[model samples]
Target: GGDGAEEEQWSQPGNDLSLPAVNQTKGKCCFSLCPGIKIPKVMDFLPNILTINDSSLPQARTRCLENGIGYREKCFYFVEDEAEWNRSETFCRSLGAHLATIDTWQELRFLLRYGGSLHYWIGLRREGSAPWTWFNGSLFNNSFQIRGRGQCAFVNGDGISSDWCSLMKYSVCSHPQTRPTGSRRDPEVWNLT
Candidate 1:
């Protein structure tokens, strides 16, 4: 009868018992009915399928060039034999860009698959006792992605080990939009200014 009652309650049409909603009550309903079975929300699931190719690369590159900051969508591969970290950072800055920001496992995998040998630095670094921070000084809250021991971070070509930032290494940069010379603002900011 309890099982039937629980099922009936869950099946109620107007009930929006999402995981987030259910979690708020400390799993009171879950423990009572389905003990030991974890019910995850749709958002909690990781995507199993993803499309990766060269066609999207150009669009990403163009967007990075247009915006001065990295846009996350455009993942670039760098030549480890060609440039060092400082050189890479300078090169990216010259083109109105900065080191890549690794926010997702998908992005990390893509970077490692594309970026060949000679580890490249990512934009994340630890600041004081606080957690890691992106190059833009944003706090990193997502812990689902893997991280290495190095204080300065780099994504490996094989996507396994982390490398030092100061060491001479190749890197990929992402720019959000092309920065305007005189104003130091992107078109979006200019409009608002």
Candidate 2:
């Protein structure tokens, strides 16, 4: 008694509160059809399991020096330290990058999957009654909702959310490939698998 639409719906996140397809293995699904039980997505519970290792510290730093980290055309680096929004922005700039800007849900999911459990600042803000904007001057199209209330934005294991701009949190930075210097960093530094 399964329709194709239901299967398709299950494949997409938010359609049935399912974990994103990218995070699922071939035979493992994050959902179960129970009569009256609340099910959490894989993303909702993976934070505790995603801790960084002390050994990987050297490799992570090396990868940052070689290029950026993350899995995309552009390079991304996760600055695992606490700093205010402005200070975080300065730190990112110091590394020849800018605070992370998500242009699609894939990028967002990639960030969340490896972003650990802590809240991290991203490149978004809403001034007064104005709409949110990324650091690169593009309008935030609201591909995802901010989970809390405030003007600044951050991403956690669950997803993106709004918070106070002055709060100190970890941050991710992005170095674009199309910069004037014409340098392209390998995006395969971080193993998404």
Candidate 3:
């Protein structure tokens, strides 16, 4: 009673039919479905597996602490104003923290969720190299899925973007001791100007 088109539509990759009738109707067609179709189990478990792997990395927790502005689990708060990339780095360093260097999607997402409205400054900049670079002078290699202007970077609930460092915006900083180890003893607090 079913045609190939119905089978194709029902069995398409990423298509989930929760309805009992649809599932029953499509169950028979699953046999002929393309092998390339992404299984729900794989889709559901892949992120979890990746998250576990990411959390196990030495840099991940440190990066989180940095983004948290020395607060172990508290999300980093941003200033109301902004400054040039160099000044921002100096500001963070004065506080014993540095500009945030995001290396994972979870980190980026956390930043975006915490940073509301204000376009915070990140460690990314384009100085000598044609391509952008992080505060440590490393290449900016993350795949930020957004379009924007300027050389400065910020991560919202979505992803990172390029903006002018000189533009006044809030920013997030990290503790220097929390580098690649997520260890922090006493964080130096800076008075923002």
Candidate 4:
């Protein structure tokens, strides 16, 4: 109250009190990120909507995709060449990423349109009659109907399909922000989330 500086701080940019309230969540919120725009629940997006531009990311801990495509809060690297599921997984591991995971209907829709006619191996792996699991050891939520019967899943023009793991298919690697820097023995404590 002694000086005019007290009043000036209330109007300061990025001040705690000046910021809008946002729900704290682990993953990205589509509603809050893009206000007023309606995103259809069903699959399919206009080709070229995401654009081909790459987002540069800091490689502070683990090896990362240098030319990865950014969608939402994740980075994706689409390997054009076909390879076996295990080989594809190895390839993704080298880049400190994993096969792309479809955690939501929106993600499934995006992947369906992104891959178009070409098949891209995703992270879904169902062992025998067991539930489908993501590459990160998370269970698939059954967000949408999965087609075909096999040990692995891939995305194509139609939707998510299951096929033999030995089949040659392109891979979609996902770079999550919280991915660890190294194996469990050499774990480095750093939070990217």
User: lDDT winner among the candidates?
Assistant: 2
lDDT tens digits, residues 1-193, model 1? 2322221112123323212223322334543444532444312321210111222121223343332323355535353444655567677676556778766677666777766565777666664445777777898676534366655567776664444555676667764443222212122212211
lDDT of each: 0.49, 0.64, 0.54, 0.63
- Candidate 4 C-alpha error for residue 14, in Å: 24
RMSD to true structure for each model, in Å? 18.0, 18.7, 18.3, 15.7
lDDT score, candidate 3, position 87: 83
Best by TM-score: 4
Task: Tell me the TM-score of each prediction against the true structure.
Answer: 0.47, 0.57, 0.50, 0.59
TM-score, cand. 2: 0.57
Residue 125's lDDT within candidate 3 is 80
Put down candidate 4 lDDT per residue, 1-193, tens digits, no spaces.
2321111111222222221122223113433433332223101221212221212222243334576766666777889989989899999988888899866677677777777899999988989999999887899888877799889998889988999999999999887554222111101111112
Ranking by TM-score: 4, 2, 3, 1
Evaluated at residue 73, the lDDT of candidate 3 is 41
Q: How many clashes (backbone N, Cα, C below 3 Å) per candidate?
A: 12, 0, 5, 0
Provide the lowest-lDDT 10-residue window in model 2: 180-189
What lDDT is reached at residue 15 by model 4? 20
lDDT of 2 by residue, 49-159 (tens): 243322212122223445466466667888888998889999999987889988888898899988868888998988876889998778989789887778889989889
CA lDDT of 36 in candidate 2?
28
TM-score of 3: 0.50
Candidate 4 lDDT? 0.63
lDDT of 1 at 54: 24
